[model samples]
Target: MLIGDVSRHSGVSTRMLRHYDALGLVRPTGRTAGGYREYSPEDIRRIFHVESLRSLGLSLKQIGRALDDPSFTPAALVSDLIRWAEDRLARERELLERLRAIDASAPEGWQGVLRIVELMQGLNSASASRRQQAVLSRPEGVPMSVDVLAGAVLTEPDPHVAGALRWALARAGGDGVAALAAGVRSADVDVRRRAVRAIAEMPEAPDATAALADVLGDPDATVRGHAALALGGRGVTSAVPVLVGMVVEGTGDVEAAEVLGALSRDPGCADRIVTALADELAAHTEDSAVRIRLTQALVELPGTTAADLLRELTHDDDRAVALIASAFVGVLDRRSTEDRDG
Candidate 1:
């Protein structure tokens, strides 16, 4: 076949076929009377080999070596090509994400697009300070997306930076709740913790509350504690048990206690909190420290129920529990007296 026929048959263009001939990669094995290049069947087969290798992301130089060099082993070259293609794919994915974010921002023009890009770069900066500044210094009209802020919050390691990111995400409205929920399901403990923290800071969206409730069963104690504390504060009765457990274990016991107190304000959940605390007290009677923490948490409950529990705990066998409960009862009594006098 002539060059034109081979180009038509193989899909390799005429220019590229002649270039392959110039490189001595697929020279014709014969010529016509008019001195035109005539490719024999073997030459056409070689052209097919070069084009096949090119499809696998091999450069022209790489393809030439693969077809002509006996010493060129395909394994290493194939591995390198795989790595290159993976890198290109990763870059393409990143580009698509950035474009989507810009699109979501609904940038009005080139300036708005530039602002969005700058904010994105700042969020992704290696310096935590820069990342925080990116979130904090967002332009007034640029309309940052919640996903960008949530993504930063999930991966942020610096405490101050994470707090700033969470704050910014919360202020951005509940749009980031989906992203934060995704973070909650992450295998990374830190990511899960940050996700819950960020979600807790947002306005009470049902999705956020539901995600937090689902997290109560997480194996990570700190993560469960965070979720429970957030859910309890949201008046979620299901969080009462986890909060009660935190009280028993003394993990985030203060926040747990406060949230439990808040939940107790609800008439429906007040009795449940009291019962859970009472049960934990019985289950771990030998654990004085646990008893003391639970006793301290009891004071957080409203009305005379907690006072009554404190009165009973005042006579308990554990000296520390008795002293703490008695002290709390006395405080509650003074507050009651002051209320009556007013």
Candidate 2:
């Protein structure tokens, strides 16, 4: 077959076939009377082979060595090809994520796009301070999309930077709750913890409250504790048990107690909060530290129920529990007097 017939039959372009001939990847077996290139059946087969290798991302040089060099081994070359393909794939994925983030930002102009790009670069900077500045330095009127903020919050390992990202998310409003909600269920413990913490700072919304509620049973105590505290602040009665548990365990018990006291502002909730504390006290009679923390927590509860519990605890067997309760009782009494006089 002539070069034209090979090109037509094998799908290799005429220019490419000539280039392959020049590179010796595929040369014609002979020539016609007019001195045009001519290809035998075997030469046509080699042309097909070169095109096949090219489809696997082989460069022309690599293809030449692959077809002509007897010492060439496919193992190392194939491994290198795999690595190159993987790297290209990773770059494409990263580029897609950046584009998605920019698209999500809904930039109104080239300047807005530039600002989002700068913010993304800042958030991804190697220096923690730069990442923090990126989040804190968003342009005054251009709000970051919730997903962008939530993504940074989930991956941020620096506590200070994480705090700033959480603050930025909170300032952006509660829309990030959904994005953070996915992080709450993450298999990574740090991701889950960060997610709950960020969500805690979000303004109370049904989705935010629901996200907190979902993590109440998390295996990690810190995650559960943060969720419970946020829920308590939102006046979600379901957080009462977790808050009470935190008090008993003495993990963040002070903040837990404060939230319980805030929750107890409701007359109906006041009794339940007091009763839960009393139940913990009754259950942990032998554990003095537990009793003391629970006792201290009771002081934050409103109404006379907690004060009554405190007065009764003053006579308990543990000296420390008794003394703390006695001290708290006096404090509650003064509060009562101040309320009455006013």
Candidate 3:
């Protein structure tokens, strides 16, 4: 076939076919009397082959190596192509996320867009101080996209930056709750931990409360402990068991005990809190440390049941536990005497 017929038949443009010939990717093997390029059947087939390889994202140089080098195996090249494509796809997705966050901010003009972009860059900066400044530098009274703030909070590894993000998120109020809730369900344990910590500081709105309640059973004890304490402070009785468990397990037991103390202020919850603590005391009687911690937790509770539990603990078989409980009993007595005199 002549060059014109080859171009028409194979759908390869004449210019491209000539370029392929110049690069030796597909050279015509025949010529007419006029010395015009004439392509043989094999030459047309090579053109199709080059097109096929290009479809797989091979660069022209790589395509040349692939077609000409007998030792260049497709396996490694294909794997590399897959990785490159995946990386490109990830970049695209990240860019799309940034665009969406910006759009959500509803920037009034180019300057507003520039500010939002600056904020995003700050949040993503390599330096922890930069990320901290990003969150702190958000202009007051100007609404930032809650999703942006929540995203920052979820991935922030620096404790200081994470704290600042959480404060900003909480200040954003319930708007960020849904995003943080999604973070709570993230498979990454660190992300889930961050999510719960941020949500724990949110106002006790139903959505925020529900989010904490939902994660109460998280596999991470730290996550569950934080959630339980947050819920307990919000007067949610469901946290009682987990709080008692924290006391028994000695993870954040002091904070757990303090939250339980606050929860016991509710008349209906006081007996349940005392009984839950008593049950743990019964179950963990063999663990002196557990007994001592539970004993001290009982001191935070009001009413006779807790006081009674303290009185009983004073005679505990563990001498250390008994001594600690004896001291607590005296403290409670003084509190009772002071209440009566007042």
For every model shown, what is its TM-score relative to the native structure?
0.93, 0.92, 0.92
Error of 2 at 30 (Å): 1.9
lDDT of 2 by residue, 141-231 (tens): 7778777889999999999999999988888863788878779889999999999998888865448888889899999999999999988
lDDT of 2 at 61: 91
The Cα error of candidate 2 at residue 81, in Å, is 1.8
Clashing pairs in 1: none
Among residues 3 or more apart in sequence or in different chains, the pairs in candidate 2 whose N, CA or C atoms overlap within 3 Å are none
Which residue pairs clash in candidate 3? none
Could you list the CA RMSD of all candidates, in the order they appear?
1.9, 2.1, 2.1
Clash tally for model 1: 0
Q: How accurate is candidate 2 locally (lDDT)?
A: 0.88
> What is the C-alpha local distance difference test score of candidate 3?
0.88
Segments of candidate 3 deviating more than 4 angstroms: 33-36, 204-206
Cα lDDT, all candidates: 0.85, 0.88, 0.88
Evaluation by lDDT, superior candidate among 1 and 2: 2
Q: Any runs in candidate 1 off by more than 4 Å, and if so which?
A: 204-206
RMSD of 2: 2.1
> Which candidate would rank higher by TM-score, 1 or 3?
1
For model 2, what is the alpha-carbon lDDT of residue 274?
A: 92
